[model samples]
Target: MKYSTVLSLTAVITGYVLADTPATCSTTGDNTPIKSGCCPRDPSKRLRRSAREIFARTDSPTCPTPKFYGDSCCTHEFAKPTLDKGTFNLQCGANGVADIVNDAVKVEIVGCDTADDLTKETCILQISSTPAGSITDTHLEISTSAWTSTKYPTKDPASWSYTSYCVKTTGVCQVPLNKIGDGASALCDKKLYIAYHTSTSDGTTSKTCTGDGTLIPGQPGSRWWEYLTLDFTCPKTCDGWCCCEKPVTPPPPPPSTQVCNIGTAFGYADGAKNLNGNPVGPAVCDTANRWGWYFATSETSLSGTLIVGAGGNDLTKGTTVGTWSATITGSDITFKYDLYDDNTNGHFDLSSVHVYASCTAPTTCAPGKFTFKDDTLTGSSDTSYTKTFSVSGGTCSTYYLIFHASVNQQIPSTGTCPTPAQ
Candidate 1:
């Protein structure tokens, strides 16, 4: 007898049998009921898939769907506000409100040359959240020692808001400190942390919880300012290399002077000392105590007066007393002497006068009767005698003269002495 048997192909693969249906087992053999499992169509082509696959997606989706990489992709783009990455401290400037990029924060500082109370100043604030809040506005104020916060819902004023209680602490509090906003007033000089949180209208909240960007006095020409609404401006500076420096002026050198003396020892005369136009000293045979003669000084040619016997008494015309004079020319020295008395006592008359010149001292060291053969002064018209000498500054020496007297003719009533030629 032949027996017919049936088995589920997915359950027992050894019971493999050929059928006309797919792996879903839709077909049955010879009037058999189809409610049970059936054989697959191609028993050798491939195994059939069942409805109970473990890793496949089913009627329900996964809790968190995979991030979309499909056409359902979205893009929300916004240019960031102009950010100042440098010091947040605003430099000194004309007083006014200063707004950071896009009104992110409004820092109003009572600015002026006369600012004293900082409490009256706008707290330096930088909020990276929704600039404006609707339906409610929350404020967190930090001061040097304490902090206060006030919350108001939509259409509610902060002053009349329901949240009236403010907690004060000696230190700063982090953002969302179980509060909408929290911060502390930091000393301008001291950098402090301030954080803010603003609830979004879309059931989202914004945070601006970090700012050591302390506000400070602006400096001229520094890059410490962004959009300044001040009446004043801080100076700006740029990187540059020094090109030139100022040159120093030097002082002038001192002047140089050369001097030449008059007279020798004993019968010595000092032309610099004997000059009468500027008489600060007396003249006599007084060389031991003071020089009595004057010296002639000239850078090129000699030109000055010198006297001998400056202490001698005066005499009548045509007679030599002792006081004598010499006027200097290029190379010549003219000498003249007067008498001791002309009061008719005719006490004395000069027989001759001597003038001397030397490149070195003494022309011959002799104290007795020095002579250089000076011209006689015998006249009633001009009693002053004039002469000339040639003396270079440092080269060539000087000499002195003495006068000798005896009886002489009466004064010439008419004829005057010849004017010496230079």
Candidate 2:
């Protein structure tokens, strides 16, 4: 049977079929319908409906109807407010934090039919700061009530209406000082989540999106689409907290070029009589009952060796204080000294303290071989003394500091001395 004859029989049976009528359809003998259904004229072609066409029609159409078999497709687009590609700048506030200037937060939106529909939608602007090496972050919402809408239905590129919100002008907005940071020219990580929703009961306001691209906890609906995260480096200079000026960093104060010319070492006596006044034989030079002198270098690690040369009429056995090596030129050097009384009596009767320096190690106490650096009298009430001398070429290098204490009193007849009264 012909295809047209079959389609005519099916169309007559059913009343609601939107597909185009084909030229013919197959039929059986005696004018009875031979085929169960009628297909489109071009089986490969399908019907596609755009948003405009779908909105224009009142009835909803489905594909593959009983009378004719074909594909029907319709597309519905969702709208959300997006940040305009226009300028967005940050300014310094009076509180020394970053703030949004007037009209700085610009949002462009479309697909709103009436002013009431506009009320159902809102765009959010958030400013936040996550300090360096900190996991915690703070957020602040700018005023969206000040958002003023201007429709440009016939714009050059495409039709889009923009809603701009001025932050400083409206009383609703304030500088988010904590979010923008507190110090001078503080840095803030700004996240502007322009969330726009269409549900009237959703109650989605500018606070709905807190710059994290997620709705407020437990709040319903996921219709928000547009989100923009801007990481703008705040400038050092801001014009009343509005526009960003280029940041200028003074070239790190030209690396300290001036080197230390002279190195100084200070020697401090523990007390008038060291060893806690504990009495012992003057010949005893053990760790206990000895006068210790603490030494430290002025210029960080002044490379040198300290030698406690024996002085006085009876003391002879010299001891090495310590040797210091510096990795960096101007490092600090320090050592300790234990002036033990090797004499028979425990009396540390000294005459004078002498500090000498030499480029090379010397065994004998010759004034000509070692250069005399400084001297301090033991009879003085001062318990501290300092030795200032020039280093080799004013650079941190190897040298020797020799300390000699001359004692005038002879050893007592007794083998041990009694502890002095405190």
Clashes of each: 46, 19
lDDT of 1 by residue, 30-78 (tens): 3332221212223342234332211111111112112211111001111
Q: What is the lDDT, from 0 to 100, of the residue 359 in candidate 1?
A: 41
RMSD of each: 40.9, 33.4
What lDDT does each candidate get?
0.27, 0.26
Clashes of 2: 19
By TM-score, who's the top model here? 1
TM-score of 2: 0.18
**Candidate 1: global Cα-lDDT?**
0.27
